[model samples]
Target: MKNTFEELKIAKSILKSLDDIGFKVPTPIQQKAIPKINSGGNLVGIAQTGTGKTAAYLLPLLTRLQKPEGNDPRVVILVPTRELAIQVGEDIAELTTYSELRHAAVFGGIGWTKHAELVEPGIDIIVATPGRLWDLYQEGVLRLKKVKHLVIDEADRMLDMGFMPQLKQLQEIIPARRQNLLFSATFSPAIEKLAEEFLDFYDKLEVAPSATTVSQVTQTAYKVPNYRTKLNLIRYLLEDEEKFTRVVIFVKTKEHAEGVFKVIQRKAEGEKRILHSNKAQNTRINAIQAFKSGDVRILITTDVSARGMDVSMVSHVINFDLPRDYDDYVHRIGRTARAGNKGDAITLIDPADEWHWKNILKLIRKDIELLPLPEEVEVLETEFGENQDQLREIDRQRKIDDPTFQGAFHQKKRKGSNKRSFDDKFSRSKERQKRKKRRKL
Candidate 1:
């Protein structure tokens, strides 16, 4: 087995760029994937996030497209989110520093005309989101005839975001003879179906099992009472600035993201930023940049917003709210413990989130340590509405497990209670009749 990039038969110019960027050895995924991709066959790579999956595909594709070709792109990389598109584009830019390979990263939120202008000059590689790519193609500004390499990065995420329709449309448009490369963090049955649709006859390469957490990360959970208490716990943990220096807090909803960011902004020691779908594209980009450069110590983001952020040296990842999608827990934690660096993942599990947390455990197939609430952190009483919401969620989970089981909130009233109500109504009607008769007499 080849261990180094050079032994893998990488081009000297690309190797020089890699060395300059401090890439010493190929990651396991890279070691296995680079060869298969270079073989010029369709390939499906299953690896967890933060495992250099991007480079595994990019290095070989870049090698194949060493120089600029036709006016249209020879390589089309499809990412699930704008963040991922930008990140992949940046990687390409860095890797091709010693070569002449023009590329463009096009996505939504910016004008399609701007992207058209970008590709009008001619591009060898085009990294784009599905929606934006389709728009450009439809506008006749971008052509697909010369696209020989079609890469679907984060296939699972694409499905989650409902990009299958666009992907299917793209499949019909792109030449059938093109090589397909699909990279996903998890290889579930859905991904298998996706592979069948996209890849003709591809080789499968898996570095790790699907939904597996990074081994270097220390996983721990805190059983909190409610959201307010979770905030208090976060404040308590952030008191240790040295330990929680660089943190990414993942929340389930934009509201939660905002709430957490506000709390951290006032209570936490260092700089903090918030990211969600509501934020402007430029704002989101700048926030990611700041977090990546270590200018910001903390980033509070929703799962959607943080999908493709590739930041190194993240000391900790805090799950402010457990993600509804079980696989997302794996992705959220993978944000830390990257590049062989040890990191910590802390999850705050409230009553409602515990069910999802348990499902996450089952998905990862591991036992996570549940830490007791810290002494300094005050566990506030659960609000009435919050308690009701927790109960409702629990009831929903129960119904999912047993379809016959009626939930507490929607349970039918007892026969005796119905009878009593009926009798009381009858008695009230009789009394009203008696009062009317007395008035008449």
Candidate 2:
């Protein structure tokens, strides 16, 4: 087993770039993957986020990237989101700093005219999202016949976001002879099925068990009463500026992302930013860049949007809301505890999140430590409106899982309401007849 980057037979220029970036040792993923990737074969890498999975493939590919020949890309990397495309493009630039490799990243939000100009001359490598890539290909701006390498990064995430159709389309369009590499955090049945359909015969590389989180992260969950109380807890925790210096708070929805940011804006005492689908592309990129440069202490984001961000040395990852999708918990926590650095993951769970919380425990195959609420963190009473909203969502989820499941928020009807229920059909008819008789008199 090669233990260091030097033992992996990387090119001098790439090695020089890595050394300049202070990458002394190869991570577990890199150690297990680089050798095979350096040689020629289709590969499937099963590893979580922050496992240096990007470098595992990028290094070897960068070494293989020769000078551009024609008006076409030699390699195409498909990511799940635009944020990831930008981050991967940045990584490629850093990795090829000492080399002469040319790359471009094309995603939505920016005008296609700009990307059209970018790929007009030619590109060595292209990192893009499925929709944007398809759009460019349809516009005759992207040529894949010259593509010698095809990489589907964050395969699980791509499939979750319904990119399988686009992937199948690209698979049919790109040259049939290129090497394929699919990287994923977990190999669930669905992901495995995707691998079987999408990838040719390939070597498998796994650094850890599926759904395994970073060992360096200390995991803890706080049982809060409601969303307002979760904010109170966040306020209490952020008071320790030294401990919570660099944080990524993960929420489930755009509304929650905005809500959390607003509260922390007035209450917390540090620079903060929010990233969500509703935000403009430049805005999201700027927020992430600011957080990466240490200009901001906190970044609140949704799971899908944060998948591509690779900020190092994150002090902590706080789950402002437990993910309904259990696998996201792993991705969220993986943001911290990176590169053998110890960090913490704090999860706030409300009554509505109990079902999702249990699923998370089952996914990780263990129970997390429960942290008692601090004295300063006052648990606020859940307001009636908020409680009903939560109950409605919970009931909706339960019905999907179990059709017979009856929940607390079951629909009820008032007698005087205009809309009549099946049980009130006769009463409504009688009321109408009484009104008609009075009118006739």
Which candidate leads in TM-score? 1
> What C-alpha root-mean-square deviation, in Å, does candidate 2 show against the real structure?
4.3
Per-residue CA lDDT of model 1 for 1-441, tens digit only, reads: 789998888887899999999999999999999888888999999888889999999999999887888798999999999999999999999999999989999999989999999999999999999999999999999999998999999999999999999999999999999989999889989999999999868898888888888899999999999999999999899989989989999888889888888787888888899999999999999999999999999999999899889988999999988888788888999999888789999999988887787788889999999999988998899999999999999999989989888878886877776455778889999999999999999
For every model shown, the clashing-pair count is 0, 0
Runs of candidate 2 with Cα error greater than 4 angstroms are 392-441
Where does model 1 exceed 4 Å of error? 413-441
Candidate 1: worst-modelled 10 consecutive residues by lDDT: 411-420
Tell me the deviation in Å of residue 83 in model 2: 0.8
Q: lDDT of each model, Cα atoms only? A: 0.92, 0.89
- Show the lowest summed lDDT stretch of 10 residues, model 2: 62-71
Quote the RMSD, in angstroms, for model 1. 2.8
Q: Candidate 1 local accuracy as lDDT?
A: 0.92
